[model samples]
Target: MPPTPATAIAVDDLVVDRGGQPVLRSVSTRIAAGSVTGLLGPSGSGKTTFIRAVVGTQKVRSGTVEVLGHPAGSKPLRSRVAYVTQDASIYRDLSVKANVAYFAALYGRSRSEAMAAIERVGMGDHAHNLAGNLSGGQKTRTSLACALVIEPEVLVLDEPTVGLDPVIREELWDQFRALAKQGATLLVSSHVMDEADRCDRLLLLREGRFIADDTPADLRAATGTANLEAAFLHLIRELEKAN
Candidate 1:
């Protein structure tokens, strides 16, 4: 396997403001290669904001972001990390395979490689289906396959499993774990505690700051909670009172 990235993504004192209000304030985190790290938070809690910041789509009002051991803002460095958004980035008019191929072409990948990505996502059989005609789950899978076509060192996913059926969600989770094993660092933001538990490590984010960073087991044990959700609620409540 390719050597795991030393530091796939690093954010230091990252701050972002939208419409004069701070969405992410002094946030700092580091994601290592070959690990799946979950960023858990509630809606409107800056989870999406932080993800866009890391991916270089949104500008930081203060501080810095480093990806693949290089500073942010470098197109070459940005190309090494794949960012998957909740809304599947695909042309509805295009076929499933065509969507993947188009993105692969943007990354300069060959036809064979794009088809291989389609296979990896288990969508090779549906390659000819129009993207608009595919189910929600299929669209999600196709989007992920496009990301894989780039063979990025780091994958940043924002609510990647939202709106999918339980079975499809589980299937995608399995694939995500496989990607981690294959040496791709994954930083996924999710509000679903069950999905968060699937990660190797968890960063419990409440209002943009990390309230707890630990394995799901450790977090549950420390908080004496029944599950990650309960533990997260407990932590967030404590954090709110502390503030």
Candidate 2:
């Protein structure tokens, strides 16, 4: 028998409400360590809320979330997990190198470590450029560099490639794969079905609930579709018919 994959995250019967309205309804899933897992869903599909819960930021209505063997967001997991939001919280006035070094220092890392991270994200060429002066894609890379400086075991990114061009998007995806190969677990959220194939496993969500949790190949085979987008639509139709 194959050895069980080590779990990086586990969520059981997770429920969350925003302003008295339900956003996540009893969602449950597990993310394997050293793999890239995609969280796919449309707008208002609870993807952000779910991620927040895993990172221990979202208040839960009921359920449990464990990260790296500790309760989600516990003080012990602070340096073990890293989260990058859609709005890349970077200092616009600071140079790319300075920003990365500053964030690294926050986590007790050093200048050399920050420079290594900048190089890892392919942002070394722009290290001296001011963040506010870079292009949208470049800024995104800067944010990723900051995240890498921490060298966390788990990385949670929200819509990291939303507005990037094809070339930059491809490069970033390659970087994600490299990180996973190095034994880092990544949970990246995206509404774009095309990006689904890049992940080792996918958590398909809709209406604040998970519709499917499987690999891209498995999902495509199950739905008899040629692509993830078609497969997702097929699954939605099946759900509607069942209801």
Candidate 3:
């Protein structure tokens, strides 16, 4: 065989509970190398919970979650995947460069090449700035830099552009597109319909289950709508009426 088709991620009928109630019920999806997928929904819609379970932080009550072709929580698999949380996880007291270096060290990246990753995220200018002093967008970029320093094959980000300004949001999307061009798999969760439109596929979630899965264009075409926001609302309304 020349090579196997690599599966970046696979979640199959995964069920999770938060506070004694189901948060993800039989939700499943897959991501492959070089594609960008969007998990689009409102807050409290189980997007974060699903991502955490995929990354092995949250325990799956039932079913399976695989990352990098291995079961979630596997040591070898962990090394090949990156999880960027809604909250930018950074050390307020540490310099931007140092912060990236710190995370790199955990992943065993050499110090000499650590700055290159930071530069890739456009944070080289603020390398010496205390992470806490950076603007929200800068902090997000720093967090992204940290997550990517190890050069993961599968990248999962939760609300990466929440606090970013419009200009910065566009810039981040450009970076995301670039990463996809490099054959990295990206799963980003967001409530913004505009951002969701940029993804190759959209996984619309509500009340802990996937309501729709299709390209933004396909979704609109199927629903006879002009935009994702309206299409999403249409789906939700139809779902409610069926119950």
Runs of candidate 2 with Cα error greater than 4 angstroms are 1-5
Ranking 2 against 3 by lDDT, winner: 2
Prediction RMSDs, each to the true structure: 3.0, 2.4, 2.5
| Model 3 agreement with the true structure over 1-243: per-residue lDDT tens digits | 111366677888899988899998899877667889999988899999999988899987898887766778789976788989888899999999899999999999977667988887778889999999999888988999998898888889999998887887887899888898899999999998989878988999999989998988999998889999999999998998999
Residue 187 error, candidate 2, Å? 0.3
Per-model TM-score on C-alpha atoms: 0.92, 0.94, 0.94
Model 2 lDDT at residue 52: 89
Q: Which ten-residue region of model 2 has the weakest summed lDDT?
A: 1-10
Per-residue lDDT of 198 in model 2: 98
The C-alpha stretches of model 3 lying farther than 4 A from their native spots are 1-6
Candidate 2 lDDT tens digits, 1-243: 122359989888899999999999999888899999999999899999998898899999998999888889999999989988777779999999999999999899999999999997778899999999998878888898899899889999988998888987898899899989999999999999889999999999899999999999999999999999999999999999999
Better of 1 and 2 by TM-score: 2
lDDT (tens digit, per residue) of candidate 1 on 1-243:
122356677888899999998888898877777889998888988988888887888978998888776666577866788989888988999998889999999989988899999998788899999999998878988999889899887898989888888987887788889989999888898988889779988987777677887888899999999888889888877777997
Query: Could you tell me which residue pairs clash in candidate 1?
Result: none
